[model samples]
Target: MRTLEETLAWVAEGTALCRRAMAGLDETSLLPGWTRGHVVAHLAGNAEALGNLVRWARTGERTPMYGSPAERDTAIEAGARLPADRLATWFDESARALADAMAHLTADQWRSEVTTAQGRTVPAVEIPWLRAREVLVHAVDLGTGVRFADLPEPFLAELRADILARRGPANVPGVHGDPAEVTAYLAGRPHTGVTTTDGAVAEPLPPWL
Candidate 1:
């Protein structure tokens, strides 16, 4: 298992990379597919939510930053129009706060369970990793041309694991062929296979979000 410090570092680095990628964009670029802005906003909201989770883990409080899905969506929509600098600042601050909290956790604390609003229990140690994955993956979803290869290897590996574990073969669009092809598919890119040994091909991703 990875250390909490390692997970925190990865989250910090991924957030920084995402901020850099979103820097200096005009409204047109920022609003691509009507999703670029929403993607960034969603990430910002995720940072806040994960930070709250860290706080709750430390304090044994069940406090939640957003009360419902509607509230979370409102937060994201409001954050979408924030200036690039402000967005970056907010993300950086949230990441730092989360990292600081994680740094003080003991191994026992890391494994402690926290109940989410959905009533599912999760380990503290997994929170940062999940947040890192969210930041990195959604950065690509912003359609700023950021590729999966630009992400850190450890994150990509984690993403691979997540896709394999959470997504069924029939449900994963664009997946076909070998492991490399599957990786590419999950990254929202096209892949070609040379042999039949490669696995079943699937439909392309839907155009609508």
Candidate 2:
């Protein structure tokens, strides 16, 4: 786990990566069936939704991330249709907004409970980690040449642990190697260098998101 300050810095770095990758919005992304626009749109919406949770923490209101999963999906699809420049603007503004909200959080506020889109209830401090994962992973998903190796080691380790915790060793069998390679394999991203305990190339895993 990261300190709040470290997590905020992580978010900033990931956000910068996304900004650089924004130039490829019109192109196909690593995510099959979704363009880079779709990925960025989802990131923008996610930042805003997380802002709602920050507000909930600060004010003691129960602000859920989204009204429903379908609502979140519809918003992402609609946002993806915007012109490229506007889509970039949307991502920038939402990211800044979420960062600002997180920055203003009191220590007590950081500990306040909030529910995730996946229905997991967690403290507000997890928001930055969540946003970090979003910006960094989706930066690669933009498919403009960013690779899993481009991500920070600490973040990748946390991500690998999270995937294993959620999906389990049974779901990601024969996995062992460099942190980046393991994370890439676990995330279902295009990867190389991952190997099993026997030193053989690791098999591909199903979707992990």
Question: Which prediction has the highest TM-score against the true structure?
Answer: 2
Query: Looking at candidate 2, what is the lDDT of residue 119?
Result: 91
Tens digits of lDDT, candidate 2, 1-209:
67888888889999999999887676788888888999999999999999999999999999999999999999989988999989999999999999988889999999999999889999999999999989999888898878888998888888888888888767667667777878989998888888888888887877566
| Candidates' C-alpha lDDT | 0.65, 0.88
Cα-based TM-score, every candidate: 0.78, 0.96
Cα lDDT tens digits, model 1, 1-209, are 56666777777777777776774433433234445566677776776787777777777787674689899878877777777777767767766776677778777777777755456678877888777777766665555666656777766676676665655556654333556445556654544551233455554443211
Among all windows of ten consecutive residues in candidate 2, which has the lowest summed lDDT? 169-178
lDDT of residue 80 for candidate 2: 86
How close to the true structure is residue 139 of candidate 1, measured as C-alpha lDDT? 60
